[model samples]
Target: MRRLQSPRRTYDWGSREEIPDFLGQPVDGERVAEVWLGTHALAPSLVDGPDGPRSLLEVSGELPFMLKILAADRPLSLQVHPDAELARAGFDAEEASGTPLDAPHRVFKDPHPKPEMVLALTTFDTLVGFRPTAEILRVLGALPTSLTQKLAERLRAEPGFAGIVALVEQLVTDPPTPQEVGDVVAACADGVQRRTDVKRAYLTALEVNEHHAGDVGVVISLLLNRLTLQPGEAAYLATGIIHAHLKGMCLEVMVSSDNVLRAGLTSKHLDPQGLVRCVSGGMSRLARVEPEQFGESTDVFSPGLREFALSMTQVSPAEPAGTPLPDQGRRIIVCTGGEVELVNEHDERLPLRRGSAVYADAADGTIRAHGTGEVGQAYTPTAEDRATPLTDLV
Candidate 1:
């Protein structure tokens, strides 16, 4: 097993304190948003070897997937990703146009679709997708006059996803007047005073407006799904699903891709056209991922994917598995609490602590982890397992 170095992605929406405090470090007073632990070219994680530091991408060469820990302080952008074909076409177009890969305005970064799973480490909140039409109507109807008038007309028409698509399209196509924007903000501000049930989303709308100014995400947030996940709870977003992480920290793992089509809640580049094309305009409900309990300390969360699988094991000093793990795929074991001794196939022990993660090669069969700590493992499948469809696995 080799210790791996994870990369941190700092964006403007990041809180300067939350993540640092979580790791038991002095809040660096600097905005620390996301920590990337996979093999996305932008900032692929590094693993230490006797010679030097090697990127995870170079190490996991032909391997099919990547794993990560995503800790967010404030909120991420309202965005969606394209399916593989669209991703490939967009990437090729950007390259052909001579657009720098690192350019802020560049949209497609790679040709891979990103289907992600995020499990809350705290009470995490987000706007996932559209809520039911009646629920949305109730939330919008409760708003103060001018703002309600603007949204009420269209929402009352019950246009479903198409109506929502049109409303968002119109707002983005013909930018709202400065006075009109002020009216919406004022309405949200007034609604905040009323303290309605949708107060959380209303507050988010105001913050989003201030962040992106006139971006259409503020209005979109109103019509999307509002979700809150307790610790150990998880949510899954498939290809073309529109969503945004609102607040608090979480552990996130996904297919290896960094392409995001932004509508708002960010100072970064906004890909309105791409975002519009990517959104599904359907009601996406909360993802229910029940942990599969095995013995007392181990619980597995497999979202029925060929690319990867994750497991969360709660270790008590009294209960220790004396044997080796069943996984044969490339595995990354991360310890979130206490310390653990990982014994290799040859019986070599690797000591790991909180926040420490190690990469174990696929061929390293039946490894043993015996100690008192909370650990999670991520891995890809073998040929035989890969041949089996995900539906059957579930």
Candidate 2:
């Protein structure tokens, strides 16, 4: 196992204290958003070697999956990722259009689908997928506005997933005027104060408007489901599903891609048409992932993604020799709590502390944890399509 130095991403929506405190570092008053622990070209982890510190890409090439510690103080952009086919087409078209890869308005960063899962380390709040059409209609009915009333009438007339999609597409593609948006926000705020049944929907609308006033995403937020996950709870986001991570820290694992099509609630580039094309208009079932326990204190969270799977193993001092980890395929192990020594079958050891990460190649046979604390492992399952192992790439 090789020790790795991961890179932390600082974004405007990140908490200044959460990541620093988690890493046991002195608060430097910087918004640390995510600590990336993989060989994605955008923010690859570093590795210490005979040639001194080197990029993880140089040591292990491209990893099929990327793991991250994400801490959001505010809401992320309301966005959706395209499927593989759409991603490839979008990337190729953009490349042909002479858009620089680093351009601010560039939508596709890579030609790969990003299906991700987030395991809450804290009370994680997120707006994910579309709520039931009935719930959305009810919320809209509670709002006192001609626009909302008209929307409710239309939805009631159709009353199904198709109507949900049509309403979303209409609002996103041909958005309401700024004055109309403000009126909607006002109505939502009033409803939030008065209606308990639609409280969550209105509260979310108020929050979105606070961040991005007069933005149509405030209206869109009412269409999605609001989920609050406790620690150890997880939610999976498949391609074409819109979501916004609202608050709290979580472990996010996904295929190595950064292609996001955004609609609103962000200062970033807006692509309503592209997002509408990429996002599904139908109601999305909540993807609440339940952990499958294996051995004592080991819970494997496999959301059935072809590229990645995550397992959280907790080791106590009483059980010095912790659980045996999956020894095949490339793995990235991150220590979330306490210190632990990662030992291999060859008696080689790599010590890790809170916030530390390590890269273990497939050749590193049967690994075990030794110490007290929790560690998360991200790896490709044996059942996955190994024909295109990312390590084959330079």
Candidate 3:
């Protein structure tokens, strides 16, 4: 097992305190959004063990999974990730157009599909896939504004998934006027005061509008499912499922890809048509994940993906023998709290504390966790693709 130094990515919609406080680092007063703990080329981790602070790619090769500790301060962009077919086509088209990989307008960063899952470490709130057309109409109808009624009429013109697609396309492409958006918000405020059955939806719209006032996405918020996950709960986001994280912190695991097609709530380049193509799958509900509990202390979050599964082992004084972790090829272990140490078959130790992480190879065999803390392991069962054994050690 080797210690790894991860990179912190900042964004405008990120928390100014949550990430830094959790990592036990001094706050720089910036919005820290995510901590990347894998080799994903765009923001690869570093080998900060005894040897040096070299890039993880040079030492361990390209790992197929990326792990992130995401903390959202406000609603993120309403975005969708492409599935395999769309990803490949988009990537090839961009490459043919001579778009640089780091170009601001570039859509697909890699040819890989991005299927991600988020495990709530706090009371995480998000706007998930589209609600049923009936439900959406009900929410919009509760607002009872001219713009919302027009939107409802548009949705009702076709109704169902087809109508939703067309309406979303219109909203992203030729959005409502700012005054119309404000009317929707005002109507939502009125609905909130009237205590409608869809009060949650109305409140969510106002919440979104608080940050992005007059933005079309605030009005579009009425079309999506409002989901709030308590601590320890999780949501697995399949490709083509549109979602926007609203608040709080979570551990996100995904296939190693950087392609994101966005429609709203961000200053980055928007891809309305591309986002429509990605969401053409017509997903309309959240995929809530049920962790597979191993023994009494370990929770394995595997969403049937060939790429990665997250294993969380709780270490405590009551079980001094330490919880035995499975040997899952190349894995990255992150400590969420307290202090912990991983003991390999050779009795070699890798100490970890809150916000610390380490890279362990399959050659270490089944390691045991000692001390008291929560250890998060990003791994998947893949016998064919395990990295070569690392010989250098502490």
Note the Cα lDDT for every prediction shown: 0.72, 0.84, 0.84
lDDT of 2 by residue, 309-387 (tens): 8888887776666568754668999999998888887889888889888998867877889888889999886553222
Q: CA RMSD for every model?
A: 3.5, 4.7, 5.9
How many residue pairs clash (N, CA or C atoms closer than 3 angstroms) in each of the candidate models, in the order given? 1, 0, 0
Q: After aligning candidate 2 to the native by TM-score, how far in Å is the CA of 346 from where it should be? A: 1.3
lDDT of 3 by residue, 247-365 (tens): 99999999999899998899889999999888855536467766666667987777778888787788988876888876546888889889998899899988889889888886888
Which candidate order results from sorting by lDDT in descending order? Answer: 3, 2, 1
Q: What is the lDDT for 193 in model 3?
A: 84
Off by over 4 Å in 3: 197-199, 382-394
lDDT of candidate 1 over 1-394, digit per residue (tens): 7888887677776768766654556876778887766677777778999899998768877445566556665568888878777889999999999998899998888878877777777788877767666777777777765655667688677557777676666665565665666666777888888777473667777866766665566777877777788988777677787888877777777777878898776778887778878877366644656666545566666666777666777766575554345476587887777878888877777888877888888556677777777777777644443332222100
lDDT, model 2, position 206: 86
lDDT of 2: 0.84
Give, for candidate 2, the lowest lDDT window spanning 10 residues: 385-394
Screening candidate 2 with a backbone cut-off below 3 angstroms (N, C-alpha, C), the clashing residue pairs are none
Superior candidate under lDDT, 1 versus 2: 2
Flag the better candidate by TM-score, 1 or 3: 3
TM-score winner, 2 or 3: 3
